[model samples]
Each structure stands twice: as structure tokens, then as C-alpha cells.
Target: MKINHVAGARRLAIPLAIAALTLGACGGSSDGGGDSSDSSSDPSKFSINLDDCNDPDSATAPIKGTFDVGYSAPLSGPVAGAVELATAGYDARIAAENAKGGIDGVKVKVTYKDDAFQPDKAKANGTEFIESQKVDALATFGTGPLSAMVDDQNAACTPMLYPSSSTDAYVDVKQFPWTTTILPLAKNEAKFLVNLIKDRFPDGAKIGIAENQTASGKVQSEAFQAAAKAADLKITEVASDADPVAAATTLKAKGVEVVYHGGVTGTCGAFDTARGRIGYEPKLVLKPSNCVNAVEYVAAGKAADGVELGAFGKDPNAPENKDDAGVKEYLAQMKEAGVPDDVIGNAVAVSGWTQADLLINTLKQAASSDDGLTRLSVMEAAREQDYASPMLINGIKWFSQPDLLTGIDGFRPIKWNAADKRFVPAGDVISIRP
Candidate 1:
């Protein structure tokens, strides 16, 4: 789990030296804006017209020292508890990177604000981040909040990296090129679930889903319906907040052989508990990737046993992954960063760490590129990344191509072992094509 500081230092230094040599050979400008004949290989290919979006005081110069980032999230609202765990991971990862001398010697400084999960507040936060705070980039949590401020971020021509949600808004490069998220698309998750059902029940089986009521939930529900239709599987839908016992009884009477809960952690827990109380046990129970939090299972108590979920990263607290190098490093870093011992292994915390890791890696790539760490270069690096993230599940690589902008390739199916209070790998990693 220990980092090789000397090797880490060398890794950062070598990239800069090579970039410098490459730039010199190509007769590029020191600011990395020189004209080049090969547009395809040009680092500035993704650079937007700053004049179109810039204000009187917009910062457009290439980063030479400190990398300033602005972050906003729901710090005191309904989702604050989950957001706080993510913040812990983000802060810990930043601390770990700074201890390693930062990305190519440029220390990262993040200014955080509480948007309280309100869209208007999120938009206002983005304005402050770009104008008042004068940060080079912006980051935030939640789909609705990020969606609320994306237009503003694009108008300001600022890079917004590693948002914590998987909404399709972040992947539309033609629309919001300044933003990208590390999370797998919710549609992709739906498709994977459909394929899983097809495999297990080749002859077809009755299915029911406890669906969320939010806008994002509607999108997810649509995806599921589309996938189910394509697979020729019948599925019944129920509102997530419906009386769980009543919902379970109705679905059971209808002979629902499988149940997929498409709500957040709380709803999932309540549904599972109600199903147990009503003595209704479907052949299989499925929860969305976002519900992989330990709190969900704890809330469901023994009812959560045998529940399955799609996960993109390893849970640090899972006994099977206790010896994993990535998990170990995360535990050490969280401990070092002063995260409480009990909260270190929370899946939400791990997700936050993963987001920070993605940003840190993207920053390094930008710094080493001929574009040399401008806001545009950071976005370019994020959109073109093609490497295995050490913090993710083994064998699941991060990739972004001209055609595929979401980056994540797939997810591993993990089953909740309530007896052990941990998630264990239940099946081989499932791949999803965009």
C-alpha cells in the first residue's frame, strides 16, 4: 500500500522533460499555442474560442504553478450525508497527491462551497467559482446540480471535471465539452441488467422494478424499458415511494420472478425490508450501482441478504478485497487524511476518492501535454483518456474515444452477503458498448 515517493517523483519529472523536448523539436511556442500542421495530433485541437465565452476578467493563461479548483455540493441537504463521505475521499486524495509533490509540481488548491443540492444555488456557485474565486476549473456532485450549472461553465469556457453523477448531460461533448464524469452511464447499467436477466432466465420471467420519481429516475426507467423491450422481457413498474409492503404483495401476486429496485439507497432499503415482512422473495433482487452503499444494507437488515448490485469499483471494507493494493492504499490515505475509521470503507467515500483520482490523473496528462495545462487542455485530456484507473475494479479500464465520451467500459456484479455485511463479486465483469 505504500507509495514509492522516489519513483513517483521520477514519473512526474520524466513526462515534463519529454513534453519539453517534443515541443522544442516541433518549434512550438512556450505557451503551447504554436501553429502545427497536423491538426489530429495537435494538443490545442480541443481548445475552444475563449473570445466567444470569456468575460472581462476570465483567466485564460496556462497554469505555471498552482492548480486552483472549485467544488460545490449538497453539504446540508437530504443527500449531504452521502456527499460528505465523498468529500472526505476527495480531500484525502488531494492530500495524498500534494504529499507526492502534486501533478508535475503544481500543487492543487480546491475551494469548496455548499449548494445544498439546489439548482439555483449550484448555478450561483458556478458563477462565484469562475468570477469571484477565479479558479481554473470547477467540480461538483449530483446530476441535477451539475446540469443546472453546465451552461454557465461552458459559457465561461471553464473545465468542469469528475462530477459525481452519471447523467447523459455530462457526455454530450457537442453541448457541454467542458464537463465529464468518471461514473458509468445509467443507461449502460440498465443494459447490463437486462443482459443479466436474459442470461439467467433464458425462457423469460416476470419482472418488476421499484422506480425512482426524480427526473433522473425517469431517464433510468426509460432506459430499463428500452432494454427490456430489446430483450423481449416483460417488466412491471411501481413508484419507489409506494407502500413497500403493498407493492411487494401486488408484484408477488402478479408472479414477478425478479425485482429490480431503481431508487436511491433509502428507498432500496425500505423496499427490501418490506419484501421480507410480506414474505415475498423474488427469485432475484437487483439494486442499482448507486445503491451499493453500506448504509442501504444496514437499513434493510437481514432482508438485504443476497441482493445483487452492479459496481465499478472495489469496496475497501469487503473482506475479499482487504489485501487488494488499491483498496489498501485507499484505506491508508483515508486514515492519513483523518477520515473517521468507521466511515473509511463506505462505498460513497470510495466513489469520491475515485473521482479525485480521475481528476489528478487528467491534470497530470494535461500538464505533460504540449498544451501545458490550460483549461482547454484539461478537458482535452479528460475526453481522450485511454488507460486503466488503478482505483477501479481490476480489468475495467477507463476509455474515451471520438465515439464514446462516457469513458467507463463496464461493471462487475457484486452480491450483498448480509451475514458478512459485505459485497462479494458474484459474476464476471459485464461489458457495455455505447
Candidate 2:
């Protein structure tokens, strides 16, 4: 695995390329005079013969169709704020692409439904996308919801593009051919986090981990234990629960010098609150997930100030990224979509935006056919590309290989500036090879 600064122009031709793709692959005559057989074979000449509804207000009227992709995520719940921000990224990217004339010639529309982070709801939404919406594909945030709907997705053969889960089981290529997890696995991420801690702190420094009791959290804890053993760092405390403040307090009592949080954004807030209460601040290291809603931690005031976080791309709120082409475009698009600057800065939003970016790029490659693209073709195309998303950190590109299930293997570390409500570069992007 190799990591470098993400440096490149925002890909401008993706929309144009998708629009320019026609039925030329069908061998239709270039000249006005064409063979009857060739003319009949042209897919462009065929009309979409959808039946019309008699009721004017029925809303089932026949109209020109656009490319429909389904997105199911928790819109309202404990993690609602984070989920909304992630969807905002998806919305911003879709608006930008549409303004550029959409994917090829068809405008892309996301049929969104809130799953409320429930597995059953996610499965139901998956069925709707397959049976009713007849979507070309599906995209989601979080691994649990994605895992819940995997069987349905596989049965329907509708590609599940980018689910925001770093769980290894969710990304098993052989088991879930219809699914693709874009981000690095949590285990790999844990290794990177440990490496950063070891490099920054002394070998004998007391380190602590605060995480949820969920499956992903357990995996993260296990990975941390292994990495800690290799790094020769002492793990003084381990906390698992909804509230991370208790864990923080325990670590503080043990005189832990550093703390790494492997839980939700709100848990980060809990840590901040606990630290504020105890008036003890250890060097806090958070994963990118915690940084997604930095403002949440901001409410805890200086407790979370100067916290360092991991990053797979340029920090969305970093002032230094203001001039970056990709950052400029993202900000502009997010603004146009009416997303507030604060929410746009969420790291989760960056995740959703990059996911859509990768899917579109892969679609462009897969849709180069006489009959247009299918879900299968898109999945196949995805496996073929070494994808470089504009939202990724400078110098690193996600490459899908034959033997590897995960596409990303590196990330940079970032620090949160409470005064500016932004994340600035804390260190260079580093690769974590398996």
C-alpha cells in the first residue's frame, strides 16, 4: 500500500462522457443512409412505452426517465446529524453532476428513504428499490444496515455501490459480489491509528481506548490490542458503552497520557464532557468518524479543542484546502444544495460525496455499451478501475485489485481547531499495508 497527498483537478469529463455515450456501439450507420437492419438495432430510436395514468393527480404519469439510484440511510435517529451530513455530500455531488448534464445524457436521481439505522427498515428499503423503484443500483451509509440488506441485494443483483462501513465481513468480495465497501477496514484503520500514537508518544506512555460494545467496536478494540502489542504501548484502560465519559474518567484516574476513541461522534462528545468534568485532558486521538461532526464536540468547549483525528483525504474544513480544486468545487456544490457550511464540513459528508464520485466514475466506464449499463456491468466495471476520488487526501487513490477486497489502505491524520471549527493537517498521509 502507498499513500500520498491527494493532488489533482476535479474530474470534469465524467458527466460529459456519460452523456456522449450513445448507441454508436450498436453499429448504426454514421451517414444519413443506413441499412434497415442497422436502424432497427439502434437503441436510441426506441421509445420508452410506459402506460399513462388516467387520473391527473395520480402522479404516475409517463415522462422521460433518468438514471435512478437508491440511497437508504438513517435520516432521523441518535446519529441523525451525522447521517444527514453524509446524505448532504451525496446530494451535493448529484447536483453538480446534473448541472454538468448528468451521467452521459440521463440526469441521475437518488430515490432516498430513511432506514432509521434499523436493519429491518434497511431490508424493506432494499426491497422497494428493487421491486418498486426498479433502481439501477443502491448506495448506503453504515455497515449494519448494509449487512441487513445483503441477501436481498445479492438476490436482485442490484449493485450496492458504497456502504459507509469499514467492517471486513461486509466487504468480502466473494460473499457479497453485489456490494462494495469503499473505505478502509476498521482493523486496518486501527493499525494506522496505533502507528500514529506510537510515533507521537513515548513507547512507555499509558494509552487508553474508549469504544462502543457493538460488533464494529469490538473489531476495533481487538485490532487496537494487536497493534498495541506490536507497538509496545501500555493500554491502561478500556471502556465500552454508550457513554465514553466514564471511560475517559477511568483512563484519567490511571494517569493515561493518551486516549484513542473508536466509537460514534456523540461518544467523542461524551469523552469531551467527561474530561471537562474531571478537568483532566489527555492527548486525545479520534478516528475520522469522530471528526465528522466536529461541531458536536465543539459544544463541549475546550475539552475537545486541539484533538487529533485520522483522515483518508483532505480535511473539508481546513483553510489550507480552500484553494484546492476539489475542495472549491465541493464547497460550491454544497452551497448550491443549501447545505450550511458547518454541516458541509462534516467528515461523513465527505464520505458520501466521495462514494458518489467513485460510483459515477465507474458507471462511465461500465456504461460504454450498445444497450447501456446494467447493475452487473457497473459492478464489473468497478472491479476494473483504480479509482481516484477528488475528495480523497492528496496523493492517494483507491485501486480495486483482483486479490484485495478493500480499496483504500492509507489515511492522513488531522487535528481539530475548536476556534475555527475546522480540521487542519496534523501529519502527512501514511499508508497502512496489510
Candidate 3:
């Protein structure tokens, strides 16, 4: 899971000094806002004016000009893997926008700060981006990185979109006015799996869930519990453990029929260990980002065959998904940029492409100021655009359905193959009602 960003981490200290507070100039522009004659080859073709597009409940009109976009990422730290995904997304966006001659002819600049996944650092970074950077809006933000300000974003009226990690705090649409998620929540994902299992594997409808004793595990537990109740399916004991092996041992003793284990692909063998011990097995439905890298997880000898995972988009290497617009471009760029195939599969690029496209839509409707960009204008511009994210192989749409402010509410059922060591589409997308 090495993100490969240590080449020049020494320079981060300088930016760290300049970006001490959350406010400053990062010099960027509104994305995808210029001549239609440029590189249309990129699948994310963003039009200049959004007049033809449908904008439902466009809260206000857009104000364009030197719009500021603030970013808070790991930039340099231990939790660098998560930040690496976020960085890749941010880079793709800035590159795309710069290629388009800048948003609304005014180039977008991002003020990025490094908090290394530390809350105090995150708070300082947020303040630096807002006060010093004077950003009119935000894009590709991390839910886990700056999670504390969930309430602050609502109070400030600063709209934001996520690259990954959709915490429950932001999922409640009513509580947060400015934040939106691009991934399906745990509850939505579990609900989709429950219904899919009922239709696909109805014969043995028992659920055995083993959750990791982590923040992620708790979130997953909430979703699985709710889904089990809704489907009227019986959920076996909820075992909490940091040791996957122990969890497997417990499940084996329970004679579990269906198992939902909460852990990364690198460590899902607990299910197999339990199967070996009990000499019995059941189907599995993991988190959306749970078992993405087939070559990594399956190659490690995990029993991936017939196991289902919830996530957006399909593997780029998968022949069926290669022809797709988003999939093809992401794979190509990742390779050209020297990013490994395994990292590309992280869905970081997809997160960027989705938000970058939406931001272009926002810029087209921005209201320009007499001298520069303003919060009122940016917010208004955001309201004028109709967000239409690219369709993922999974049942989820990158953008919300009816409500423009909502987050990504769709997911796909991916089946893992022990033989091929990859995830294949099990069924259609499960769309969650917001």
C-alpha cells in the first residue's frame, strides 16, 4: 500500500511553514471552463455553459473569477496511504483544469496542507485554507482527515465533495448543508447486499458478521445490523476482534451460514480460517472498498471465489470494463504517471474525475465579481449546475439522483473468484434512496 510520495517530502516543511494557518493563496481556477476545442479526447468532456443541462432547485446563480479551492491531505505522514489516494485525485483535477485553459478562463489554485491524519493539524490546515487561502469553495475533501469540522462546514455554507471515506456524520443530509459524499455509506451498502443475497442466494439466508475492533468496523456493524433487520434475516452473534483468526474461530463454532467480515483485503483470511476449522462455509458481502485489489488479496491465497464485495466501478484490468470511458482513461493516466496498477484500482482517480466534472459544471454557472470571486457567487454557481456523475459498473451513480446536494448513493455487487483471484460483477447496482 505504498503511495510512492516520499521522493521529496523534505520540501513539505517549507509549505508547512507558509500554510501554518488555514488561509492563504494557492492559485487555482474553476475546473473545465474553457474553449471546447481543446483535448476532448479525455472522456470527462466538460462543456462551457450549462444552459442545456438540467439543474433542479438551483439554489442560486454562480459567481465566477479566481475561485479558490482548498485541500487538506496527508501530504506527508504515517496514514500516507489514505492521503496518497486523495493526492492522486487532487493532482488529476488540477492537471485536467490547467489543460482546459483554467475554469471560466480563471485558473484554479489549490491550497494544500499536511496534517498527517492528526486532528489538531487538520484543524490548523482547515483554518489556513479558509482564512489565508481565502478559497471560495472546496473539492475532493477527506471525511476522515477533517472529520471534526462536520458542523463547521454547515455553518459556513462552504460546499464540499469527498474522494473517499464517507463517514456517517456527513451522510445525514439534513445536518450538513455543504458536504456531499461520492461513495455509498455502510448502511446503504449492506442494504444492497441483503437484497442481492435474498434474490441471488435465498436458500441459506443466515448472516454471521465478524467486525474488526476499529472505527471502520463499528461503522460497518451499524450498517449490517440495520440491513439484517430490514431483510428479516437472522443475524448471528456480532463478534468484535482485532485478530481475524480469532474471529474466524468464533464463526466456525457458531456454524455460520453467511459471513460478513470487516477487514481490508490484505487480511480477510479469518473467514477462510473459520471455514477450515468448521468444515462449513457461507456466502460473503464485504464493504465497498473492502476487497478491491484482486491481484493483491486473491494472490495472497484468500478464498475469493463467489465472495461478493460492494464498490463503485469494476477493475480496470477486467476486459469487460476496459471499453468504459472512466476506466480506460484512469488506467492510462495512472500508468503514464508511474502509479502502480494496484494503486490505480484504489478508486482515487474515479473520485477525482467525478468531482472535477461536477466542479466544471459549477464554474459554468458562477457569478463573476467586479474584482474577484466571492462565496455568494460560488455557492450560487454550484446551485445552477445539474450534477451527472459517470455510471459505475456497480449499481451506484457517481452523483445523487433527485437531490443535487446529496452524495453518491449507488453500489455494485462484485463476486470474487479464488481461481482468477478477482472480483466480477454479481448483479445490477443497488440504488439507495436519499
Candidate 4:
């Protein structure tokens, strides 16, 4: 319910102090030893006894072992498009990891059930994940309509589930223990929008927020409003219409200068037309969710222009992503596997992949010791530190966010160039150094 932009470095970082991250707690050593010479001196270290595949001395092994991760998403529901995109991202990520010899040479087992984009299903899957499958932890579990399962995850005492949903309430780590987000927090995006508006628009500029009536959209709208007010900007109105483009046209006619909208890719495109219709140009800030692939949002040439959006996560097309540790490799694997590269890049798949990536690392750490290889160990690993994925916000490394109850709420403020059909970071995000 809030949209504004501000710039600053990350204030809090995961305590990297030795005390905060106990060497034996996760059973792995974060400190890099002197050299391979010393490791070779103890031939026993080469016996392939540890869980960390990061061991450079030996060849990464294949999936001789088995562990499970679960997913809760809408395979059938209204937001199925978004859910599908995320699922594809997950599958591609899995295929890539498996192709390169799974974590610790053990293949990861991903099991999933569709929540039909329904909350009941999400809750149900959460229970199953914690009790039955006994997975190391949940990964990229789409909240769908579930809002969240922080209490459920905590009640089940599960480890962090790298979540893709963005509910600002979960920013607090003290509450939710079993999930992390990849996108910059929605509140942060809102804050970012504020700065953008002040710098772009002049005095007496009318700003309005038109968002989908969903809880997420409403939350974004409010956050935008609060930030706008803090910056001494005036909000023209808040419209609950389900259609963004139509609503955008009406709001523009009402003399709106900046429009903040929370809608799907389709609705956001309509906002583009609203600008031309009114003959008055207004800066448009879209919810980060709509900032992704223009394949859908900007279908026709020149349909979407001057659209300011909030990206809740990484830009799939960033050049820096080329050198990302595993990106090229993932793309190669997907290509060889005959899976559509686009499928792998889909939002759902990205969330799934993000979830899988963090879980794999946690599993390695949890399995470090012979005695503590239970779900509890994995849970602890999820809590101990943040997972820095290649596609996360600039400064923020996502661990299990305890706030939003689910893994949603991770987002960044990004802008879209209708000409290029790409997402670029609109402003700086505050977080730890990668």
C-alpha cells in the first residue's frame, strides 16, 4: 500500500561475527584453509567424506544420494500465469544443478503439489512439508493466495523456505523463521518510488495509487503513500479498480501526475495507453511484479513507454548476471536438457531455482556432521545466515525473512524501457556486499 523511493546503504547485516555463526553449528568451515597442499597432506580429507561440494580439490560428484524439497504454488488458479512462470524458473534451476552434479554429489529431489493458487492448498502443503515429506526445508514456495505460513513454518519448526511472495509484514526475522525472499522488500521499493517522484515531478503534481485489490497490492499502495507523505508530496487519490490501464486513463484525466499501480503484466500495459489518451504525460510507477519480461506487458511496439516500475528482485537480463557464478552454466544445462531457455527464466522457475539453490547450500551445511543430519539441522542452517543468490538485490542478501510469514515481499524498484524491453535498476538498494 506504499510506493516511494529513497537511497541509502544497508543498515543491518547478518552478523558475520564468529559468535553469530558458530563453526560447528552448521558443521562446515566458512574459513578457507591455507592451500590444497595442506589438505593433500591429510589424504583422509580426499576421501569424499564431507557434505560441501564447494571443495575445489575434488571433482563434483553426481546425485548418488537423495534429499527432498517441496513447492506450494498455484498450478491451477487465477494467477496461474505468474505461478507457471515461477514454476518454470524452478524446473530450470533444478535441471541445471542436477546436470552439474548435485550438492555434495547428491541429487536434490523436488516434490510439489499445486495449491491452485489457493491459500488452503498453500497451508496444506506447508503442513505436509514440515510433517510428512520432512524435507530439509521449503524452497521458493510461492505463497499464491496463502498470505503466509510463518506461524505454520515456525510451529513445524522448519528451516527457511526461500519464498518469492512479498508481504512486507515478514521483513522481521524474529517472527517467521522458515523463509527468505529474493526481491527487495516492497516497503523499500515504496521508499525508492518516493525519491523518484520528487526528482521527476514538479510542485502540485498529483499522484494516485491504483492497485489490484489483493492484499499484496494494497500493502504496496499504503507503503507508497506513507513514503510520499514523508517526502511532502501530495497523493491525489487511491482507486481500487481492478483494471490498471482503464483506471490509469481515468486518473490521468483527473489531472494525476504520477500513478502507482499494483496489477498483473496485462493491466500495467494499459497504463501506457492512458498517457497518450490524456495528452498529458504522467510518470507511471508499476509494482515490481509487473516489471519483468515485456513479452506480455509490452506486446506491441511503442505500447509501453515511460513506465517506472518497482522490481522486487533481480533483472534477468543484467549483464553482470553473465558473470554470475552459476548463470551461464545454468543456461547451458537448460539448453542441453532441451528445456526452453525462456522456461528456465520464467518467474516461477526463478523462484523455484532460488529456493532450490539456498536449500542445497543449507543441506550441505546441515549434512556436514554425521550426527545432526535431521530436519532440525537444516532448519538451523536456514537461520544461521543469509543466502546470497546471483539474482538478489544489489546489497540485500536474502536469508529467511521472518516477517511476511511467507517468502514473498522480496522486490526492488526498477524501470522498464519499452524500446529495449528490459528491466534496469531504477535506484540503489541497501544491503550487504555480495
Q: How accurate is candidate 2 locally (lDDT)?
A: 0.66
Worst 10 residues of 2 by lDDT: 4-13
- lDDT per residue for candidate 1 within 392-415, as digits (tens), equals 888787787532475678789999
In candidate 3, stretches whose alpha carbon ends up further than 4 angstroms from where it belongs are 1-66, 74-79, 118-120, 138-146, 171-174, 264-281, 289-291, 331-342, 345-348, 364-388, 394-396, 401-406
Q: How many residue pairs clash in each candidate?
A: 0, 12, 38, 60
For residues 181-247, could you state the per-residue lDDT of candidate 2 as single tens digits? 7767777777777777767765457888876665456666677777788767778888764665577
Q: Candidate 3 lDDT, tens digit per residue, 282-356?
A: 555454454454444454354445666776655666778768876766665556556655667665445554556
In order, candidate lDDTs are 0.73, 0.66, 0.53, 0.54
**Number of the top-ranking candidate, with TM-score as the measure:** 1
TM-score of 2: 0.79
Shift in Å, residue 95, candidate 1:
0.8
Q: What lDDT does model 4 reach?
A: 0.54
lDDT tens digits by residue: candidate 4, 14-97: 222123222222222335464432222222222111232222111112213766667676667656666566656566667767
Ranking by TM-score: 1, 2, 4, 3
Candidate 1 achieves a global lDDT of 0.73
- Tell me the deviation in Å of residue 249 in model 3: 1.9
